[model samples]
Target: MDIEEVRKVASLARLSLSEEELATYGEQLTRILGYVKVLDEVDIEGVDPMPHAVDLQNVFREDAETESLPREDALSNACKTDGQYFQVPQILDQKD
Candidate 1:
């Protein structure tokens, strides 16, 4: 990529770069793109796409009814709360 293209991208990413940094980044990005171009030329006719390198499986147990924690005990861990409910900071910008 060119220095101007790098400067545009850096501006979009909210980065503050000097002229030297822009030139350095331009060269680095060009090298990275060249490496990716080489990867694109590789043959993978029968290769399966993988999300993870290792095999993974979810192990589940038999589900049974269980007792839940009491309301008073559950509310004990809150930073701030009313008598019956958790009181969190208001997030909206309304007058009410």
Candidate 2:
């Protein structure tokens, strides 16, 4: 990538980069693109496309229900509360 290409990308991303930063990012993007070009030359005639790099099976544990906390105990540490629920400041303005 050239400085102009980097500048264009920075503008599109709404970035305010200095001249030195533009030059630095241009060189970095060029190197990264070079790596991608090298990957294009790799031979993968029979390789299958996979979602993950490694094989994964059912990795989750079985869900089981347990006893729930009492309502009073759950609301004990609240900063402010109504009789049955937590009270928080209203964020939206009421319009007529």
Candidate 3:
């Protein structure tokens, strides 16, 4: 990548780098891409794909159904209500 292209990417990522730093990163990114190209030529016909760097297992407990609180008790704490539902002020601005 060129220094101008690196500068544009830095601007998008909210980074502030000097012109010398941009020139340095431009060369470094090109070298990294070259290494990736070399890795692309490796053979791995029988390799098993691994999703994670380390193995993991689920540790959650079993779920159980339970009774819930009554609606009257749940709505008892509301400041304003319309018999069965809570009421609140208008959220949006005035409209025509």
Candidate 4:
């Protein structure tokens, strides 16, 4: 890709790149696209897309609450609290 095209992409992505960084990314992206182009040459008549390379299953346990702190104990760490609730600046309430 040309430097101008690369700059345009950087603008769209909200990126600020110095001249060196821009040149580096431009070269790297061009090389990646060239490799992707080569993959199109491969013929896979009966190949199927796989979720994993090896047989695997979920090993996670079911979600269950083991223990929970009391409301007063949980609120003890807050800088400001009104009994049980935390005292935070209400952004939405001030919008009107």
Which candidate leads in lDDT? 1
User: Per-residue alpha-carbon lDDT of model 3 for 14-58, expressed as tens digits?
Assistant: 999998889999899989988889776778789888888887787
Over 4 Å off, model 2:
42-96
Which residue pairs of candidate 1 clash? none
Q: 1 or 2: which has the higher lDDT?
A: 1
Score each candidate by Cα lDDT: 0.90, 0.89, 0.86, 0.90
- Tens digits of per-residue lDDT, candidate 4, 1-96, equal 888989999999999999998999999999998888987888877998787998678789979988799899999999999987999888785866
Cα displacement (angstroms), candidate 2, residue 2, comes to 1.2
Evaluation by TM-score, superior candidate among 1 and 4:
1
TM-scores of the candidates are: 0.44, 0.43, 0.44, 0.43
- Give model 1's TM-score versus the native structure: 0.44
Spell out the clash pairs found in candidate 3. none
User: What tens-digit string does per-residue lDDT give for candidate 2 at 1-95?
Assistant: 87899999999999999999999999999998988887778788898888898899878976888789988889999998885899987867955
Enumerate residue pairs that collide in model 2.
none
Runs of candidate 4 exceeding 4 Å displacement: 42-96
lDDT for each residue of candidate 1 in 1-96, tens digit (9 for 90 to 100): 988899999999999999999999999999998888877777888998888888778878779888999899999999888969999778799576
